[model samples]
Target: MEIRQLEYFVAVAEEGSFTRAAERVHVAQPGVSAQIRRLERELGHDLLDRSGRAVTVTAVGAAVLPLARAALGSVESARRTVEEMAGLVRGAVRVGMVVSCGVMDVPELLAAFHTSFPGVEITLTEANSDELVSSLVDGRLDLALIGYAGPAPDGLAVRVLADEPLVVAVTDADPWRARESVPLDELLERGVICLPPGTGLRGALDEACGTRRPRIAFEVSAPPMVITLARRGLGPAVLAASMVPPDLHAVRITDPVPSGALAFAWRAEGPHSPAARALIGLAENRVTAP
Candidate 1:
Protein backbone atom coordinates (compact mmCIF):
# COMPACT_ATOMS: atom_id res chain seq x y z
CA MET A 1 0.00 0.00 0.00
CA GLU A 2 2.91 2.32 0.64
CA ILE A 3 5.07 3.73 -2.17
CA ARG A 4 8.14 2.23 -0.47
CA GLN A 5 6.48 -1.18 -0.53
CA LEU A 6 5.83 -0.95 -4.24
CA GLU A 7 9.41 0.08 -4.84
CA TYR A 8 10.71 -2.90 -2.90
CA PHE A 9 8.30 -5.24 -4.70
CA VAL A 10 9.34 -3.98 -8.10
CA ALA A 11 12.99 -4.26 -7.19
CA VAL A 12 12.59 -7.84 -6.05
CA ALA A 13 10.49 -8.73 -9.07
CA GLU A 14 13.04 -7.31 -11.45
CA GLU A 15 16.09 -8.75 -9.73
CA GLY A 16 14.40 -12.06 -8.91
CA SER A 17 16.32 -12.46 -5.68
CA PHE A 18 15.67 -10.84 -2.34
CA THR A 19 19.38 -10.51 -1.60
CA ARG A 20 20.14 -8.99 -4.96
CA ALA A 21 17.22 -6.59 -4.70
CA ALA A 22 18.37 -5.52 -1.23
CA GLU A 23 21.86 -4.94 -2.54
CA ARG A 24 20.53 -2.91 -5.41
CA VAL A 25 18.25 -0.83 -3.19
CA HIS A 26 20.91 -0.52 -0.47
CA VAL A 27 18.81 -2.19 2.17
CA ALA A 28 19.48 -5.17 4.44
CA GLN A 29 18.18 -8.48 3.09
CA PRO A 30 16.05 -9.15 6.17
CA GLY A 31 14.55 -5.66 5.98
CA VAL A 32 13.56 -6.22 2.35
CA SER A 33 11.98 -9.58 3.15
CA ALA A 34 10.08 -8.12 6.11
CA GLN A 35 8.74 -5.30 3.93
CA ILE A 36 7.61 -7.75 1.27
CA ARG A 37 5.82 -9.84 3.87
CA ARG A 38 4.11 -6.77 5.20
CA LEU A 39 3.08 -5.72 1.71
CA GLU A 40 1.63 -9.14 0.95
CA ARG A 41 -0.32 -9.15 4.16
CA GLU A 42 -1.81 -5.77 3.36
CA LEU A 43 -2.69 -6.86 -0.17
CA GLY A 44 -4.14 -10.16 1.08
CA HIS A 45 -2.27 -12.23 -1.51
CA ASP A 46 1.13 -13.71 -2.14
CA LEU A 47 3.18 -11.87 -4.70
CA LEU A 48 6.19 -14.10 -5.25
CA ASP A 49 6.90 -17.78 -4.86
CA ARG A 50 10.42 -18.64 -3.77
CA SER A 51 11.64 -22.17 -4.26
CA GLY A 52 15.18 -23.58 -4.46
CA ARG A 53 16.81 -20.14 -4.65
CA ALA A 54 14.63 -19.19 -7.60
CA VAL A 55 11.73 -16.78 -7.47
CA THR A 56 8.71 -16.40 -9.69
CA VAL A 57 5.93 -13.88 -9.53
CA THR A 58 2.55 -15.21 -8.56
CA ALA A 59 -0.51 -14.40 -10.67
CA VAL A 60 -1.48 -11.57 -8.37
CA GLY A 61 2.02 -10.17 -8.50
CA ALA A 62 1.93 -10.18 -12.32
CA ALA A 63 -1.35 -8.27 -12.26
CA VAL A 64 -0.13 -5.60 -9.84
CA LEU A 65 3.41 -5.09 -11.04
CA PRO A 66 2.55 -2.87 -13.97
CA LEU A 67 0.25 -0.71 -11.88
CA ALA A 68 2.89 -0.37 -9.20
CA ARG A 69 5.47 0.65 -11.78
CA ALA A 70 3.16 3.30 -13.20
CA ALA A 71 2.47 4.69 -9.76
CA LEU A 72 6.16 4.91 -8.96
CA GLY A 73 6.86 6.55 -12.31
CA SER A 74 4.17 9.14 -11.63
CA VAL A 75 5.64 9.92 -8.23
CA GLU A 76 9.09 10.34 -9.73
CA SER A 77 7.71 12.57 -12.50
CA ALA A 78 6.04 14.81 -9.94
CA ARG A 79 9.31 15.14 -8.04
CA ARG A 80 11.10 16.01 -11.27
CA THR A 81 8.52 18.67 -12.13
CA VAL A 82 9.04 20.35 -8.77
CA GLU A 83 12.79 20.20 -9.18
CA GLU A 84 12.50 21.74 -12.65
CA MET A 85 10.50 24.67 -11.26
CA ALA A 86 13.46 25.49 -8.98
CA GLY A 87 15.73 26.08 -12.01
CA LEU A 88 17.26 22.63 -11.64
CA VAL A 89 17.15 20.70 -14.88
CA ARG A 90 17.88 17.36 -13.23
CA GLY A 91 16.22 14.11 -14.23
CA ALA A 92 17.26 10.83 -15.78
CA VAL A 93 16.57 10.23 -19.44
CA ARG A 94 16.56 6.60 -20.50
CA VAL A 95 17.49 6.19 -24.14
CA GLY A 96 17.22 3.05 -26.25
CA MET A 97 19.29 2.98 -29.40
CA VAL A 98 19.92 0.56 -32.24
CA VAL A 99 23.56 -0.45 -32.80
CA SER A 100 23.83 1.59 -35.97
CA CYS A 101 22.42 4.65 -34.26
CA GLY A 102 24.88 4.15 -31.42
CA VAL A 103 27.71 4.29 -33.98
CA MET A 104 26.31 6.94 -36.29
CA ASP A 105 24.28 9.34 -34.12
CA VAL A 106 24.51 8.69 -30.38
CA PRO A 107 27.93 10.18 -29.74
CA GLU A 108 27.02 13.57 -31.19
CA LEU A 109 23.62 13.62 -29.59
CA LEU A 110 25.04 12.70 -26.18
CA ALA A 111 27.74 15.31 -26.48
CA ALA A 112 25.29 18.03 -27.40
CA PHE A 113 22.84 17.15 -24.65
CA HIS A 114 25.52 16.84 -22.00
CA THR A 115 27.09 20.12 -22.99
CA SER A 116 23.72 21.86 -22.89
CA PHE A 117 22.36 20.23 -19.73
CA PRO A 118 25.13 18.95 -17.55
CA GLY A 119 22.87 18.37 -14.59
CA VAL A 120 20.57 15.98 -16.39
CA GLU A 121 21.52 12.33 -15.97
CA ILE A 122 21.54 10.18 -19.08
CA THR A 123 21.37 6.40 -19.28
CA LEU A 124 21.82 4.74 -22.62
CA THR A 125 20.95 1.18 -23.58
CA GLU A 126 21.84 -0.32 -26.94
CA ALA A 127 19.30 -2.70 -28.40
CA ASN A 128 17.84 -3.74 -31.71
CA SER A 129 14.83 -1.91 -33.13
CA ASP A 130 12.30 -4.43 -31.88
CA GLU A 131 13.69 -4.40 -28.34
CA LEU A 132 13.81 -0.62 -28.34
CA VAL A 133 10.18 -0.37 -29.44
CA SER A 134 9.07 -2.84 -26.79
CA SER A 135 11.03 -1.02 -24.08
CA LEU A 136 9.57 2.32 -25.15
CA VAL A 137 6.04 0.91 -24.92
CA ASP A 138 6.70 -0.62 -21.51
CA GLY A 139 7.90 2.70 -20.03
CA ARG A 140 11.47 1.46 -19.54
CA LEU A 141 12.87 4.00 -21.97
CA ASP A 142 11.97 7.69 -22.17
CA LEU A 143 12.73 7.66 -25.90
CA ALA A 144 14.42 5.56 -28.53
CA LEU A 145 16.46 5.96 -31.71
CA ILE A 146 15.32 3.09 -33.88
CA GLY A 147 15.00 2.12 -37.51
CA TYR A 148 11.79 3.24 -39.20
CA ALA A 149 9.39 0.37 -39.79
CA GLY A 150 5.61 -0.02 -40.03
CA PRO A 151 3.03 1.94 -38.08
CA ALA A 152 4.24 3.79 -35.02
CA PRO A 153 3.07 2.74 -31.59
CA ASP A 154 -0.57 3.87 -31.19
CA GLY A 155 0.18 6.79 -28.92
CA LEU A 156 3.78 7.57 -29.77
CA ALA A 157 5.25 10.38 -31.85
CA VAL A 158 8.09 9.61 -34.24
CA ARG A 159 10.60 11.86 -35.96
CA VAL A 160 12.69 10.46 -38.79
CA LEU A 161 16.30 11.52 -38.35
CA ALA A 162 18.18 9.97 -41.24
CA ASP A 163 17.88 7.48 -44.08
CA GLU A 164 20.92 5.19 -44.00
CA PRO A 165 21.56 3.18 -47.13
CA LEU A 166 22.56 -0.47 -46.86
CA VAL A 167 26.10 -1.39 -47.84
CA VAL A 168 28.16 -4.54 -48.12
CA ALA A 169 31.15 -4.55 -45.81
CA VAL A 170 34.06 -6.83 -46.57
CA THR A 171 37.72 -7.17 -45.77
CA ASP A 172 40.10 -5.03 -47.80
CA ALA A 173 41.75 -8.15 -49.16
CA ASP A 174 38.47 -9.66 -50.34
CA PRO A 175 37.78 -9.80 -54.05
CA TRP A 176 34.67 -7.63 -53.63
CA ARG A 177 36.94 -4.82 -52.46
CA ALA A 178 37.67 -4.02 -56.08
CA ARG A 179 34.07 -3.19 -56.82
CA GLU A 180 32.64 0.29 -56.46
CA SER A 181 29.12 -1.08 -56.36
CA VAL A 182 27.64 -4.54 -56.36
CA PRO A 183 24.26 -5.86 -57.42
CA LEU A 184 21.94 -7.12 -54.65
CA ASP A 185 21.46 -10.49 -56.34
CA GLU A 186 25.19 -10.97 -56.81
CA LEU A 187 25.82 -10.09 -53.17
CA LEU A 188 23.26 -12.67 -52.12
CA GLU A 189 25.18 -15.39 -53.97
CA ARG A 190 28.39 -14.18 -52.34
CA GLY A 191 27.00 -14.94 -48.88
CA VAL A 192 26.00 -12.27 -46.34
CA ILE A 193 26.95 -11.95 -42.68
CA CYS A 194 23.77 -10.65 -41.18
CA LEU A 195 22.66 -9.43 -37.79
CA PRO A 196 20.23 -11.67 -36.01
CA PRO A 197 16.51 -10.94 -36.10
CA GLY A 198 15.14 -7.91 -34.16
CA THR A 199 17.71 -5.50 -35.55
CA GLY A 200 16.34 -2.73 -37.74
CA LEU A 201 19.00 -3.14 -40.40
CA ARG A 202 18.49 -6.90 -40.47
CA GLY A 203 14.79 -6.42 -41.12
CA ALA A 204 15.54 -3.94 -43.89
CA LEU A 205 17.98 -6.38 -45.50
CA ASP A 206 15.41 -9.15 -45.30
CA GLU A 207 12.82 -6.99 -47.00
CA ALA A 208 15.24 -5.97 -49.73
CA CYS A 209 16.53 -9.48 -50.46
CA GLY A 210 12.99 -10.92 -50.77
CA THR A 211 12.95 -14.56 -51.90
CA ARG A 212 16.54 -14.51 -53.17
CA ARG A 213 17.67 -15.69 -49.69
CA PRO A 214 21.19 -14.53 -49.13
CA ARG A 215 23.44 -17.26 -47.82
CA ILE A 216 24.04 -16.32 -44.18
CA ALA A 217 27.37 -17.70 -43.10
CA PHE A 218 27.36 -16.15 -39.65
CA GLU A 219 24.97 -14.20 -37.48
CA VAL A 220 26.24 -11.49 -35.17
CA SER A 221 24.48 -9.19 -32.74
CA ALA A 222 26.95 -6.36 -32.34
CA PRO A 223 27.85 -4.04 -35.21
CA PRO A 224 31.56 -4.09 -34.41
CA MET A 225 31.55 -7.90 -34.25
CA VAL A 226 29.92 -8.06 -37.65
CA ILE A 227 32.64 -5.80 -39.03
CA THR A 228 35.36 -7.84 -37.32
CA LEU A 229 33.94 -11.06 -38.70
CA ALA A 230 33.72 -9.55 -42.15
CA ARG A 231 37.26 -8.23 -41.83
CA ARG A 232 38.45 -11.76 -41.14
CA GLY A 233 36.95 -12.75 -44.51
CA LEU A 234 34.06 -14.61 -42.91
CA GLY A 235 31.66 -12.98 -45.39
CA PRO A 236 30.13 -9.69 -46.44
CA ALA A 237 27.71 -8.07 -44.01
CA VAL A 238 24.65 -5.91 -44.73
CA LEU A 239 24.72 -2.82 -42.60
CA ALA A 240 23.84 0.84 -42.64
CA ALA A 241 26.33 2.64 -44.83
CA SER A 242 27.28 4.99 -42.03
CA MET A 243 28.12 2.15 -39.62
CA VAL A 244 31.00 0.74 -41.66
CA PRO A 245 34.07 0.85 -39.45
CA PRO A 246 37.02 2.91 -40.61
CA ASP A 247 39.21 -0.14 -41.16
CA LEU A 248 36.67 -1.88 -43.38
CA HIS A 249 35.63 -1.10 -46.95
CA ALA A 250 32.00 -0.86 -47.98
CA VAL A 251 30.43 -1.35 -51.39
CA ARG A 252 27.11 0.15 -52.27
CA ILE A 253 24.22 -2.08 -53.22
CA THR A 254 23.28 -0.75 -56.64
CA ASP A 255 20.61 -3.07 -58.02
CA PRO A 256 18.20 -2.26 -55.20
CA VAL A 257 19.53 0.32 -52.81
CA PRO A 258 18.18 -0.91 -49.50
CA SER A 259 17.95 1.59 -46.70
CA GLY A 260 16.09 2.30 -43.48
CA ALA A 261 15.28 5.51 -41.64
CA LEU A 262 16.47 6.22 -38.13
CA ALA A 263 13.84 7.78 -35.94
CA PHE A 264 13.41 9.24 -32.46
CA ALA A 265 10.19 8.12 -30.82
CA TRP A 266 8.47 8.95 -27.53
CA ARG A 267 5.07 8.69 -25.92
CA ALA A 268 2.63 11.15 -27.46
CA GLU A 269 0.29 11.25 -24.46
CA GLY A 270 2.84 11.78 -21.71
CA PRO A 271 4.10 15.20 -20.82
CA HIS A 272 7.60 15.69 -22.08
CA SER A 273 10.07 16.62 -19.38
CA PRO A 274 12.38 19.53 -20.11
CA ALA A 275 15.36 17.19 -20.35
CA ALA A 276 13.54 14.90 -22.77
CA ARG A 277 12.51 17.87 -24.89
CA ALA A 278 16.03 19.19 -24.92
CA LEU A 279 17.43 15.78 -25.92
CA ILE A 280 14.85 15.49 -28.71
CA GLY A 281 15.79 18.91 -30.01
CA LEU A 282 19.45 17.92 -30.07
CA ALA A 283 18.71 14.65 -31.85
CA GLU A 284 16.70 16.48 -34.53
CA ASN A 285 19.28 19.19 -35.08
CA ARG A 286 22.57 17.33 -34.69
CA VAL A 287 21.61 14.08 -36.39
CA THR A 288 21.90 15.52 -39.90
CA ALA A 289 25.11 14.60 -41.71
CA PRO A 290 27.40 17.25 -43.12
Candidate 2:
Protein backbone atom coordinates (compact mmCIF):
# COMPACT_ATOMS: atom_id res chain seq x y z
CA MET A 1 0.00 0.00 0.00
CA GLU A 2 2.78 2.39 1.05
CA ILE A 3 5.90 3.14 -1.04
CA ARG A 4 8.24 1.80 1.65
CA GLN A 5 6.13 -1.35 2.03
CA LEU A 6 6.34 -1.99 -1.71
CA GLU A 7 10.09 -1.44 -1.49
CA TYR A 8 10.32 -3.94 1.34
CA PHE A 9 8.30 -6.47 -0.67
CA VAL A 10 10.47 -6.12 -3.75
CA ALA A 11 13.67 -6.31 -1.72
CA VAL A 12 12.58 -9.34 0.29
CA ALA A 13 11.38 -11.16 -2.82
CA GLU A 14 14.63 -10.52 -4.68
CA GLU A 15 16.99 -11.27 -1.76
CA GLY A 16 15.04 -14.38 -0.64
CA SER A 17 15.71 -13.55 3.01
CA PHE A 18 14.13 -10.95 5.21
CA THR A 19 17.45 -10.36 6.99
CA ARG A 20 19.30 -9.73 3.74
CA ALA A 21 16.52 -7.52 2.39
CA ALA A 22 16.60 -5.50 5.60
CA GLU A 23 20.33 -5.02 5.29
CA ARG A 24 20.08 -4.05 1.61
CA VAL A 25 17.46 -1.41 2.45
CA HIS A 26 19.29 -0.29 5.61
CA VAL A 27 16.26 -1.12 7.74
CA ALA A 28 15.61 -3.46 10.67
CA GLN A 29 14.27 -6.93 9.91
CA PRO A 30 11.31 -6.55 12.25
CA GLY A 31 10.32 -3.27 10.63
CA VAL A 32 10.50 -4.81 7.16
CA SER A 33 8.40 -7.80 8.29
CA ALA A 34 5.79 -5.56 9.89
CA GLN A 35 5.50 -3.40 6.77
CA ILE A 36 5.11 -6.41 4.50
CA ARG A 37 2.51 -7.87 6.82
CA ARG A 38 0.55 -4.64 6.77
CA LEU A 39 0.73 -4.55 2.97
CA GLU A 40 -0.43 -8.18 2.66
CA ARG A 41 -3.38 -7.39 4.94
CA GLU A 42 -4.41 -4.51 2.67
CA LEU A 43 -4.03 -6.64 -0.45
CA GLY A 44 -6.07 -9.54 1.10
CA HIS A 45 -3.51 -12.10 -0.15
CA ASP A 46 -0.20 -13.54 0.97
CA LEU A 47 2.62 -11.86 -0.90
CA LEU A 48 5.38 -14.04 0.52
CA ASP A 49 5.68 -17.63 1.73
CA ARG A 50 7.62 -17.60 5.02
CA SER A 51 7.20 -21.38 5.61
CA GLY A 52 10.70 -22.19 4.33
CA ARG A 53 14.14 -20.92 5.30
CA ALA A 54 14.40 -18.86 2.12
CA VAL A 55 11.46 -16.59 1.46
CA THR A 56 9.71 -16.79 -1.89
CA VAL A 57 6.98 -14.60 -3.33
CA THR A 58 3.47 -15.90 -3.86
CA ALA A 59 1.84 -15.77 -7.33
CA VAL A 60 0.20 -12.46 -6.45
CA GLY A 61 3.51 -11.00 -5.28
CA ALA A 62 5.30 -12.16 -8.45
CA ALA A 63 2.59 -10.49 -10.55
CA VAL A 64 3.00 -7.21 -8.65
CA LEU A 65 6.82 -7.23 -8.54
CA PRO A 66 7.44 -5.58 -11.91
CA LEU A 67 4.75 -3.00 -11.24
CA ALA A 68 6.32 -2.19 -7.89
CA ARG A 69 9.76 -1.68 -9.43
CA ALA A 70 8.34 0.51 -12.17
CA ALA A 71 6.51 2.64 -9.64
CA LEU A 72 9.65 3.11 -7.56
CA GLY A 73 11.65 4.05 -10.65
CA SER A 74 9.03 6.56 -11.68
CA VAL A 75 9.03 8.18 -8.25
CA GLU A 76 12.81 8.43 -8.28
CA SER A 77 12.84 9.88 -11.78
CA ALA A 78 10.28 12.51 -10.80
CA ARG A 79 12.29 13.44 -7.70
CA ARG A 80 15.44 13.78 -9.79
CA THR A 81 13.66 15.93 -12.36
CA VAL A 82 12.30 18.30 -9.71
CA GLU A 83 15.66 18.52 -7.92
CA GLU A 84 17.47 19.21 -11.19
CA MET A 85 15.02 21.97 -12.06
CA ALA A 86 15.46 23.55 -8.63
CA GLY A 87 19.28 23.32 -8.92
CA LEU A 88 19.45 21.02 -5.87
CA VAL A 89 21.38 17.77 -5.62
CA ARG A 90 20.04 14.92 -3.48
CA GLY A 91 20.67 11.21 -3.96
CA ALA A 92 22.69 8.25 -2.76
CA VAL A 93 26.34 7.82 -3.73
CA ARG A 94 28.12 4.50 -3.31
CA VAL A 95 31.87 4.99 -2.97
CA GLY A 96 34.66 2.45 -2.67
CA MET A 97 38.17 2.91 -1.30
CA VAL A 98 41.20 0.65 -1.31
CA VAL A 99 42.46 -0.74 1.98
CA SER A 100 45.50 0.84 3.71
CA CYS A 101 44.83 4.19 2.08
CA GLY A 102 47.22 6.64 3.73
CA VAL A 103 48.18 8.73 0.72
CA MET A 104 45.36 11.27 0.99
CA ASP A 105 42.91 12.64 3.56
CA VAL A 106 39.76 10.94 2.31
CA PRO A 107 37.75 11.75 5.43
CA GLU A 108 38.25 15.47 4.84
CA LEU A 109 37.06 15.20 1.26
CA LEU A 110 33.95 13.21 2.22
CA ALA A 111 33.12 15.58 5.06
CA ALA A 112 33.30 18.58 2.77
CA PHE A 113 30.92 16.96 0.32
CA HIS A 114 28.50 15.98 3.09
CA THR A 115 28.57 19.51 4.43
CA SER A 116 27.72 20.86 1.00
CA PHE A 117 24.93 18.37 0.28
CA PRO A 118 23.49 17.28 3.58
CA GLY A 119 20.50 15.57 2.00
CA VAL A 120 22.61 13.20 -0.09
CA GLU A 121 23.33 9.80 1.46
CA ILE A 122 26.84 8.40 1.19
CA THR A 123 27.75 4.73 1.48
CA LEU A 124 31.47 3.97 1.66
CA THR A 125 33.00 0.57 1.04
CA GLU A 126 36.65 -0.49 1.48
CA ALA A 127 38.21 -3.08 -0.82
CA ASN A 128 41.46 -3.88 -2.58
CA SER A 129 42.24 -2.09 -5.86
CA ASP A 130 41.38 -5.04 -8.11
CA GLU A 131 38.05 -5.70 -6.42
CA LEU A 132 37.19 -2.02 -6.44
CA VAL A 133 37.84 -1.82 -10.17
CA SER A 134 35.51 -4.77 -10.77
CA SER A 135 32.85 -3.16 -8.59
CA LEU A 136 33.14 0.08 -10.58
CA VAL A 137 32.81 -1.74 -13.89
CA ASP A 138 29.78 -3.66 -12.65
CA GLY A 139 28.09 -0.48 -11.42
CA ARG A 140 28.19 -1.61 -7.80
CA LEU A 141 29.97 1.60 -6.91
CA ASP A 142 29.69 5.14 -8.28
CA LEU A 143 33.27 6.14 -7.51
CA ALA A 144 36.36 4.56 -5.99
CA LEU A 145 39.70 5.61 -4.53
CA ILE A 146 41.88 2.75 -5.72
CA GLY A 147 45.58 1.94 -5.85
CA TYR A 148 46.92 0.72 -9.19
CA ALA A 149 50.03 0.06 -11.25
CA GLY A 150 50.91 0.35 -14.97
CA PRO A 151 48.02 1.38 -17.22
CA ALA A 152 44.53 2.29 -16.04
CA PRO A 153 41.78 -0.27 -16.30
CA ASP A 154 39.47 -0.22 -19.34
CA GLY A 155 36.20 1.78 -19.24
CA LEU A 156 37.30 3.96 -16.33
CA ALA A 157 38.71 7.47 -15.94
CA VAL A 158 40.95 8.48 -13.05
CA ARG A 159 42.25 11.46 -11.18
CA VAL A 160 45.69 10.57 -9.88
CA LEU A 161 46.22 11.32 -6.21
CA ALA A 162 49.65 9.80 -5.51
CA ASP A 163 52.09 8.44 -8.08
CA GLU A 164 55.30 7.39 -6.33
CA PRO A 165 58.02 4.79 -6.59
CA LEU A 166 57.70 1.58 -4.62
CA VAL A 167 60.52 1.19 -2.14
CA VAL A 168 61.93 -1.41 0.23
CA ALA A 169 61.51 -0.34 3.85
CA VAL A 170 64.16 -1.57 6.27
CA THR A 171 65.02 -0.98 9.87
CA ASP A 172 68.38 0.43 10.98
CA ALA A 173 69.56 -3.06 11.99
CA ASP A 174 69.17 -4.35 8.41
CA PRO A 175 72.24 -4.21 6.15
CA TRP A 176 70.25 -2.69 3.28
CA ARG A 177 69.24 0.30 5.46
CA ALA A 178 72.25 2.32 4.36
CA ARG A 179 71.68 1.69 0.64
CA GLU A 180 70.21 4.35 -1.64
CA SER A 181 68.44 1.81 -3.83
CA VAL A 182 68.30 -1.91 -4.47
CA PRO A 183 67.81 -3.77 -7.74
CA LEU A 184 65.11 -6.38 -8.37
CA ASP A 185 67.75 -9.15 -8.52
CA GLU A 186 69.19 -8.24 -5.11
CA LEU A 187 65.70 -7.98 -3.64
CA LEU A 188 64.92 -11.49 -4.91
CA GLU A 189 68.21 -12.79 -3.58
CA ARG A 190 67.80 -11.26 -0.10
CA GLY A 191 64.04 -11.88 0.17
CA VAL A 192 61.52 -9.15 0.99
CA ILE A 193 58.37 -8.58 3.04
CA CYS A 194 55.36 -7.70 0.91
CA LEU A 195 51.67 -7.08 0.82
CA PRO A 196 49.65 -9.98 -0.60
CA PRO A 197 49.06 -10.34 -4.35
CA GLY A 198 46.38 -8.11 -6.03
CA THR A 199 47.52 -4.98 -4.23
CA GLY A 200 48.88 -2.05 -6.26
CA LEU A 201 52.30 -2.26 -4.59
CA ARG A 202 52.56 -5.96 -5.36
CA GLY A 203 51.37 -5.39 -8.93
CA ALA A 204 54.12 -2.87 -9.48
CA LEU A 205 56.69 -5.21 -7.97
CA ASP A 206 55.55 -8.12 -10.16
CA GLU A 207 55.68 -5.90 -13.25
CA ALA A 208 59.18 -4.71 -12.44
CA CYS A 209 60.45 -8.20 -11.62
CA GLY A 210 59.04 -9.54 -14.96
CA THR A 211 59.73 -13.26 -15.37
CA ARG A 212 61.94 -13.18 -12.28
CA ARG A 213 60.28 -13.53 -8.88
CA PRO A 214 61.16 -12.04 -5.49
CA ARG A 215 61.67 -14.06 -2.33
CA ILE A 216 58.61 -13.20 -0.28
CA ALA A 217 59.66 -13.59 3.35
CA PHE A 218 56.30 -12.61 4.79
CA GLU A 219 52.91 -11.53 3.50
CA VAL A 220 50.65 -9.10 5.35
CA SER A 221 47.35 -7.63 4.28
CA ALA A 222 47.76 -4.26 5.93
CA PRO A 223 50.53 -1.92 4.78
CA PRO A 224 51.16 -0.75 8.36
CA MET A 225 51.48 -4.36 9.50
CA VAL A 226 53.98 -5.02 6.69
CA ILE A 227 56.10 -2.10 7.99
CA THR A 228 55.73 -3.36 11.56
CA LEU A 229 56.82 -6.90 10.67
CA ALA A 230 59.79 -5.59 8.67
CA ARG A 231 60.80 -3.32 11.55
CA ARG A 232 60.90 -6.33 13.84
CA GLY A 233 63.57 -7.82 11.53
CA LEU A 234 61.28 -10.18 9.63
CA GLY A 235 62.50 -8.80 6.28
CA PRO A 236 62.59 -5.66 4.15
CA ALA A 237 59.08 -4.60 3.05
CA VAL A 238 57.92 -3.52 -0.40
CA LEU A 239 55.53 -0.54 -0.33
CA ALA A 240 54.98 2.97 -1.62
CA ALA A 241 57.77 5.42 -0.81
CA SER A 242 55.46 7.68 1.17
CA MET A 243 54.37 4.77 3.42
CA VAL A 244 57.83 4.50 4.95
CA PRO A 245 58.22 6.46 8.16
CA PRO A 246 61.29 8.51 9.16
CA ASP A 247 62.56 5.80 11.56
CA LEU A 248 62.58 3.25 8.72
CA HIS A 249 64.76 3.83 5.66
CA ALA A 250 63.25 3.58 2.18
CA VAL A 251 65.48 2.02 -0.48
CA ARG A 252 64.03 2.55 -3.93
CA ILE A 253 63.74 -0.63 -5.98
CA THR A 254 65.32 -0.14 -9.39
CA ASP A 255 66.05 -1.95 -12.68
CA PRO A 256 62.84 -0.13 -13.51
CA VAL A 257 61.39 1.79 -10.61
CA PRO A 258 58.27 -0.02 -9.45
CA SER A 259 55.62 2.68 -9.25
CA GLY A 260 52.20 2.57 -7.59
CA ALA A 261 49.43 5.08 -7.98
CA LEU A 262 46.52 6.07 -5.75
CA ALA A 263 43.70 7.42 -7.87
CA PHE A 264 39.99 8.29 -7.79
CA ALA A 265 38.35 6.27 -10.54
CA TRP A 266 34.87 6.25 -12.02
CA ARG A 267 33.19 4.99 -15.18
CA ALA A 268 34.53 6.54 -18.38
CA GLU A 269 31.05 7.81 -19.21
CA GLY A 270 30.74 9.44 -15.74
CA PRO A 271 28.56 8.93 -12.66
CA HIS A 272 24.77 8.56 -12.85
CA SER A 273 24.09 10.62 -9.73
CA PRO A 274 24.68 14.31 -9.19
CA ALA A 275 25.88 13.51 -5.67
CA ALA A 276 28.75 11.44 -7.06
CA ARG A 277 29.72 14.18 -9.48
CA ALA A 278 29.56 16.76 -6.67
CA LEU A 279 31.71 14.63 -4.40
CA ILE A 280 34.34 14.08 -7.12
CA GLY A 281 34.21 17.76 -8.00
CA LEU A 282 34.75 18.68 -4.36
CA ALA A 283 37.70 16.31 -4.17
CA GLU A 284 39.20 17.80 -7.31
CA ASN A 285 38.87 21.28 -5.83
CA ARG A 286 40.54 20.24 -2.57
CA VAL A 287 43.03 17.48 -3.40
CA THR A 288 46.45 18.32 -4.83
CA ALA A 289 48.18 15.33 -6.41
CA PRO A 290 51.59 14.29 -5.11
What would the TM-scores of all predictions be?
0.60, 0.70
Q: Locate the minimum summed-lDDT window of 10 residues in model 2.
A: 83-92
**Candidate 2 residue-wise lDDT, 1-290, digit = tens:** 79999999999999999999999999999999999999999999999999999999999989989999999999899997787634335577888898878777777777877787778888989877889999999989988898888889899988898899999989989998789998777888987888888778888898888898888888888888998898898889988988998889999888888898889988888546667777777766765767
Top candidate (lDDT)? 2
Q: Residue 10 in model 1: shift from native, Å?
A: 45
| Residues 130-248 of candidate 1: C-alpha lDDT, one tens digit per residue | 88888887778888887854455466778877677899988878888888899888888877888888887787787787786778888888787888788788888888888888878
Model 2, position 47, has a per-residue lDDT of 93
Query: What stretches of model 1 exceed 4 Å from their correct place?
Result: 1-90, 100-108, 111-119, 149-155, 245-247
Error of 2 at 164 (Å): 0.7
